[model samples]
Target: MSGVFIVSDNILSPIGLTTSKNFGQLKKSVSGIQKHHDTALSDQPFYAALFDQSGFIKDSDHKYTRFEQLLMASISDALQNSSVDAGDKKTVLIISSTKGNISLLETESYNPTIQKRISLPASAKLVAEYFGFINQPVVVSNACISGIMAILTGMRLIQSGQYENAVIAGADVISKFVLSGFQSFQAISPGPCKPFDVNRDGISLGEGAATIILSANPKNAQGIKVMGGAVSNDANHISAPSRTGAELCQAITKTLDNAHLLATDIDFISAHGTATIYNDEMEATAITLANLQTVPVNSLKGYYGHTLGAAGLIESIVSIHSLKENLVIPTLGFNETGTTNPLNICTDLLSGNFTNCLKTASGFGGCNAAVVFSKQ
Candidate 1:
């Protein structure tokens, strides 16, 4: 099997519209999460990282939904920066999102026509057609792990000789339904989230999109590769994560084993630090279980809030750039250790020669996923 390398990428978020711009902001410790009082989203004030629709709009004809608009903008920007031809017969498109076009359900009444429009496959095909993709578009919507799962899906397809190139895009937007659902669970933080911090309470929701283009050919002689990945499920409660980190540890160990690397080989970890009580504790337990407790870890939730589906890919992109730039970004809102197992959380920017990094994500239904990225 051939190695899958990232050729080009773009990030469309409140912080920036390009990957470089987002990385720059992270280096300066800037955050996109802010307090907003929008009655349309919630009756009370809430904090989130959201794009102003009027200012972020690229489509003049309004032919697509907000979700589709994000995917097209991100994909177009990424394609412009890469030589990969998305219209080629050997190219495939993969879309990842927990909720696609779900906002329409709030505005429009439920009907067959509206239902078809909101389907993930339907929205994926429309975006694929707009971008001239010939092959069927693959959709990954496994809760919050959708982003990493989608990336792994693309890597497998390329390694299996099914496609020469893959454009994987992941996105999600905040809506009334989404806000209320989190509110019902009392999961929305009153202010910016504090991942792995003693003061942390809940997650601050966010909206954004990111696109990562992968190809069998390296972008350069020393390009980054999608080395290996693994997924696991605890079969625990649907909404709550595992009481113990044993299952997530299985996924991490398996990923390291698949990559032919030991726990000490990893340079750092880009954790799925949602700032919620159980999630942070479970992730810490898992990392310690894998004998990676000493590895420096950071969470972007403080900067981007919890972007849900986009969280995994967005954080992974930052980590990739960190390797290329030789700088480790700090965890924005972390001040003290709060989990049962202590973690070496990066609190300040550190310069070093990084080679490999681990990206992990856990979502609802007790599902957990892990993927290893290496610089060759």
Candidate 2:
């Protein structure tokens, strides 16, 4: 069986539109996070990375919401150079998001009609129909791990011999609903978030979309393989992660084992450093438990902010490009090591020949996931 490979990908963020553009911005240590005083989003000023509403892409048909628009744009760009037929029976589409059309709730209450529009499955159907996909679309809304899980779902579907190609698109838009919820928890940082730093306070929210095309045929792949991945749940708390990082560690161990890799074989790590106190500490402990303490690690949250469902895919795309270019992107806002277990955080852009990289994510439901990408 041909391994599941990333044929093409795209990232639509405040920093850039395509994956290459985003990677270029990261190479220069550019950050999209900034302070905003939009009353529509918050009563008080907050820092976040958001798209320019004035210049956002629009469609003549008002039926498609902003969330669906983002998914369509990303999927269109990802399929530009690939021969994957969206309308073909052997192709599948998977959508990952934490909140799909949740913004509609701000204006209207939950009614039968409104609920149908706000439903993730309904939004996914709209996107799939827009792309002319023949199969029923799959939706992954597993909090922050949604993106990685969507990718893993595509891999498994292809491995099951049910599809030859899988187009995975993940997106989330920042809105008043999302902002107020995070604010309620005091998880919104006043300034730019400093991941893995002692003075780090909270996460800087962001909005973006990303798409990764997976193909069973390796002939035209980008010299990278979706090696293997695994997910775990600690079930310790609804919003907080496990204190000991044991569950996250289990996820990393299983992912490495699935990929037939050892901790020593991993060249770098793309950590799910949300800049939150507990998240960083827990992730650091998990990394140490997996014996990846010395591996060069970094997080893109400082650049793109915590993009919720899109975080995993956006960070994974950056890591993929990093592996191809042999350059490690510096952790944008990290200054000093603050985690209890300590991590070899990349503070400067370094060039080295490395083959495999690990990307990890932990989310609201005590969920943790780890995926490995290798240069084929």
Candidate 3:
């Protein structure tokens, strides 16, 4: 299969509006999470990373909700950095999000006429129209792994000659619906999340949008290339992951095989460390099962919290930057080993030559995905 290169990318998050700004915050170990006492979101104090509403763009001619504005801003910034034309027939758009415009259902005025906008397909169509994309936009909503799966889909589409280039973006805003659902599971951390830490309790939810432009042509591209990707399911439970991590191990092995590389070739890992007990433990088991216990691993959740559908894409972009800068970002809230298997968890920023990286994410419904990226 032909390799897909990431030509340009953007991230709109609580810490920053552009990819460089977000990455700069990450380099400085700045945490975007904060405590909130809003009764609209939750009755109790909760920690979350949220975009400032005051900084949002306001336009009367094309009024867009906060969620839609985030997607537009991210994609706009990404397209500005890329040579691909959004209006060209050869280009495609792919959106990844577990929930798009779901917050529209919580309007204070409650306009029933706008209910249809909450549908994922409808939201995607609106964004596509705004961007002038010729092809119908594709939507991927496979839980937290949605972002990586979208990228994988784009790679396959380009490799199969379905499209010459793909613009992929994902965003999910934190709303009362999502917050209450996770709260029912007792999965919300009281404070900032501590991934892979002995004192880790639960996840700190976050909201963000991310975009990446992928193309088969890599002429002047100095960015990382998508070498391989694989997705697998445990089918063990609806909400819980497999106890043995066998399914995730298969995903990692298949991803490496598709990339024509081995576990040792991976310089580091960008893990889906949600700070939840089962999630961190399961990832550790999978890494050990894949004989990657010695490989350095870090999670961005400590800095950005859990960005749901946007997590994989946002972390992938940061990992690409990590490769470009030859630096390994430390796991922000880690203090000690918490899982059964020993993992080379990065506790501080380390500088070294990095060539290849493995990114992994596991979500609800027992779904897991692994993608390999290499510096070209």
- On lDDT, the leading prediction is 2
Off by over 4 Å in 1: 55-57, 219-222
Ranked by lDDT, the better of candidates 2 and 3 is 2
1-376: candidate 3 lDDT, tens digit per residue: 6768989999989999999998899889998999988898999989999876733555566567777778888999999988999999989999999988887777644565576677788878888988899999999999999999999999999999999899999999999999999999999998899999999999999999999999988772766899998999998997998999999999999999999999989999999999999999999999999999999999999888999889999999999999999998999999999999979999999799999999999999999999999987
Pick by TM-score: 2 or 3, better one: 2
How displaced is residue 82 in candidate 2, in Å?
1.4
| Candidate 1 lDDT tens digits, 9-114 | 8888898999999999999898999999999999999999988664344567877898888888889998898888878998999999999999999999999999
Error of 1 at 39 (Å): 0.2
The lDDT per prediction is 0.91, 0.93, 0.91
Per-residue error (Å), model 1, residue 363: 0.4
Minimal lDDT window, size 10, model 2:
53-62
Model 1 vs. true fold: TM: 0.98
- Candidate 2 regions off by >4 Å? 54-58
lDDT of 1 at 300: 91
Candidate 1: clashing pairs of residues:
none
Give candidate 2's TM-score.
Answer: 0.98
